[model samples]
Target: MRIYGPSGTTIGSPAGNTKRSGSTGFSLPDDAASTQATRPAAAPKAAANIDALLALQGIEEDPVERRKRSVQRGKGALDVLDDLKLGLLAGNFDASTVGRLREAAANLKASSGDPGLDAVLSEIELRVEVELAKAGQF
Candidate 1:
């Protein structure tokens, strides 16, 4: 008869008691039993305290300063778009198309203020589509 493991993989044969074999490929030495006898017993789990958890809720502070610091930090959307334009022109496009895309992006930046970067990106995407269409890439 076959004995299967938890995942249904067959482990070994289960025949007569004298012929029964476990999964261990090698025989254990007689000294192995003595080595296991001296191991320390595992410690019991600690009980949870509801009062300690409730006390932690009162210690937490508000985050007004962190919000102000984040608002002041880092480049805004226009800076990122300018960088992307530079990368695109440097990678594949000719000078005339890159120039027109850059001019449209600048116009978009001036008109839309902070939110205009999205429009600028959209303009660049349109320019790429037009170029790709010219080359029959799309």
Candidate 2:
């Protein structure tokens, strides 16, 4: 393979084209040229951008953490279901308990990034829905 460079070019003063061609030149917009630009300082803008990036990084959940959270939520939902069952058997269940079960069902809808866990949660949600439906709350 032949590596070709500019013809007749030397290390010093290569091509030596100092003039700007019309095709390569740039012009500002007429409105921009007429205004005194009031741009914010670079430091604050850079700081703001860095802060925003950090905030976004913080918002992203780790897969392991998300899975753990989903497990905890599932356990909580199961606990609530148990409480509801106990309440019903004891004839003390009320609207608030049903509301909590509904909320748990809603929370279960979020993905845990694990197919197995998701399947389990879906089953739990279905059970919750069935219970709610039986109670005429659905």
Candidate 3:
């Protein structure tokens, strides 16, 4: 069946239409038609795959919450590093204390947009790594 408009012209005539395949009677090309036809079967599988990926990544926090958490982690890492520095200066730090500092450096990753803070963080990580090596725990 063909549809005619008000002027009695077939609506889907293939003249000057690149979207239509002439051999397919002004319809979608064969490959495109097959793709459109198979969409329903693929949709559910695609959705399931996306859900699985999100699950693996964990629930995504909003930007504000993410930034806040990052800031908190950076703060905690800085605090621990401060104590380690003081302990070093005082000449009374144990292997486990250095281990905690190493763990902090390994896990924390945040830049407070301050170059000094980033430099201090790098120093802390390096200092902890050296201490761990000296203790034969690295």
The TM-scores of all predictions, comma-separated, are 0.22, 0.56, 0.41
Q: Which ten residues in a row have the lowest lDDT in candidate 2?
A: 1-10
1-138, model 3: which lDDT tens digit per residue?
554334656656753433644476654344555566543444433455776886665456465665565566667766776776787789887666766767776755555455665576666567656656765743
Candidate 2: residue 87 lDDT (0-100): 88
Per-residue CA lDDT of candidate 1, range 1-138, in tens?
344334554546443333325764634445555678666888987648877775675345234443332222222323444554676678864555445444543433322223344454456555544543553431
For model 3, which pairs clash? Answer: none
* Candidate 1 clash pair list: none
Residue-level lDDT of model 2, residues 4-122, one tens digit each, is 24464355543332334578564443554558777876764345578788668747979898899899999989998999899889987688888898899888888998999999988
What is the Å distance of residue 103 in model 1 from its true position? 22
Top candidate on lDDT is 2
Task: State each model's CA lDDT, in order.
Answer: 0.46, 0.79, 0.61
The prediction achieving the highest TM-score against the true structure is: 2
Q: List candidate 1 stretches off by more than 4 Å.
A: 1-28, 31-114
Candidates 1 and 2, the one with greater lDDT: 2
